[model samples]
Target: MELNRFYCGDAIKIMQTFSDNAIHLICADPPYNLGKDYGNTIDRKEWSAYETFTRDWLTQAIRVLRNDGTLYVFMGVRFIARLYAILENDFGLLFNGWITWHYTQGMGRIKGYSPRHEDVLYFTKSKDFTFNLDDIRIPQKYYRERNNMDGANPGDVWQFSHVHYSSKEREEHPTQKPEAVLERMIRASSNPGDIVLDPFVGSGTTCKVARDLGRRWIGIDVNPDYIAMSERRMAQTATLFDSFDPRLKRTPLDLPR
Candidate 1:
């Protein structure tokens, strides 16, 4: 229940204690039921059980979220559709966008296409939501006098490399997310001093990014090891973040004379 701290417990139970409409942003990366090992827990779950579990935690997330608060959930292809339906129809959360996280490489397949992308669902509790577009804009592809000089919207499809084993930011977790990806989400959805909640904080990417941006954050995970990992990871400060959307580095074209 404490702000800017990591709690080791069930996501739904921990969220139930938070004050209603208190959290300004909720960025959750729950288990994808992929049968992966996560120390004290396994990612696999019975289909019906998984659905119920998702609904329970999401219900609590919606409850603690402010009317203007935004929620971004990272999900795998298998459950993205069902989760979308739950968020849209069951919870009545307004659909903001469906984000595709494109990675350059992934598991290659002999019988089918290689998997290379993940999906994130963005929704808001109400129509009125906080979106600091400038905070998340990427470098424009071309220069035009009519275009906003600050930058351009990164758009729904984003490109961020995976936290591969060779990367320094890579943690022991099987599905660690890129920090820059979470950074963009936090920067766009919440303001300084606002409370950000991540009920299924896997590697603590959300909490760390929020902290660096001056937003208060709460992270919860059932695995004690993961909670510990988050604490250590969030403590370190660096001159630069690990990665960024490639569009941010592209050079804009020269303007007409």
Candidate 2:
């Protein structure tokens, strides 16, 4: 219920206390049901039980979201389609984009190809939503005379490196997201001083990025360790925030005209 702070509790229960249409943006990265250890909480759930959990939390998220608010949910391949159905068919939120987060390295497989991507479903509560395309634009591949000259629209498929265990930005959480990924979402969807909510704030990437960008944030996680982890990470980041998209280094090819 508090803004710009991390609350340790059940996401659904905590979210219920929020007033209606109070959130400008919601970035939810719930359990993928992969049986990963999350400290005091089990990631594994029965198929029906998982569906119920997903539906309930999503309902709360949608309730708190403003009419023009945007919601971006990170999901695994196992339940991506079902989640999409719940958002579009059941809830009727307008489908905005299906973003693919492509990483270079991941678990390799002998029987099949190694998985290198995760999907994020972007939806909006209504037709008109806040999307500052210029705010999120990445450097263009090549500069042209007729081009806007600002930057190019970062397409649906995004390339950001994983916060590797060796990296300093890596947190204790198993499925911690890259900070650059959340930064793009927050910058594009919400304005400065707007309230951004992360219901399942694992590792608190969303909240940290929101705060660094001058937006109000609320992050709730069931695990106390994660809350502490996020707090330490935020405290350490005063001037410079964590890592960024690797592609940001690419300078647009200059053309003589």
Candidate 3:
């Protein structure tokens, strides 16, 4: 279990080698069983099989997480409820918040409402977990005395645009998440020099953000190509994040007269 390295293998198997309570934070974006193509593997599974897969990896994830550690899991609408139950009722992890990643643009559906958001389940191993409020705060919309002028808590609903296909920062991976999302999660949950782990590091967003934020990281992915993709992203430097919360640019109104 070397730090700041990517392992290409089964996530469950790789995590089994990790020492108990070794990871400070885990930001996982596992497959959603939506029949998407991930090059080497298809994101499709039977309902029962997917549930078992989810439980197996999560068991390993929880074992390697420190008592004061935090975990953020990205999942689609289909299985979010089931995931929540497993994390809380089944495993007894401390329920924290259920975040909504609202991407402005997405596939339109004629039969139903267009899908514009995904769910991120946040949990902590214990009540004494790390949470740097100021680290992930967004600017307030109004200049009120009651409000903390420093910044307001970026609430459960997060708004970050998807990396468009033509964007320079976009990777070849099908389900690539924006780096700013990971940036917020890492900043809020873990401190510098802490160990961050991503079991299903699809496009390496978690590892890259962890490295940039000065944390030790371990990324495990089954696809060798994706492992290489993550390596290339780590090597490159960026002046600005690919996406961000729109509220970050807002100016608080109603200044004192």
Model 1 bad stretches (over 4 Å)? 255-257
| Model 2 weakest 10-residue run by lDDT | 237-246
Q: Write the per-residue lDDT of candidate 2 for residues 75-152, one digit (tens) a residue.
A: 999999999999999999999999999998899999998999999999999988999999988778788877776878
What range of 10 consecutive residues in model 1 has the weakest lDDT sum? 238-247
Rank all candidate structures by their lDDT, best first, as comma-separated numbers. Answer: 3, 2, 1
What is the RMSD of candidate 3? 1.1
- lDDT string for model 1 (177-211, tens) is 88888898998999999999999898888898899
lDDT of 3 by residue, 179-199 (tens): 999999999999999999999
Instruction: Answer with 1 or 2, whichever has the higher lDDT.
Output: 2
The C-alpha TM-scores of every prediction are 0.96, 0.95, 0.98
Two-way lDDT contest, 2 vs 3, winner: 3
Question: Any idea what lDDT model 3 has?
Answer: 0.94
| Reference-based TM-score, model 3 | 0.98
lDDT of 3 at 195: 98
List pairs with backbone clashes in candidate 1: none
lDDT of each: 0.90, 0.91, 0.94
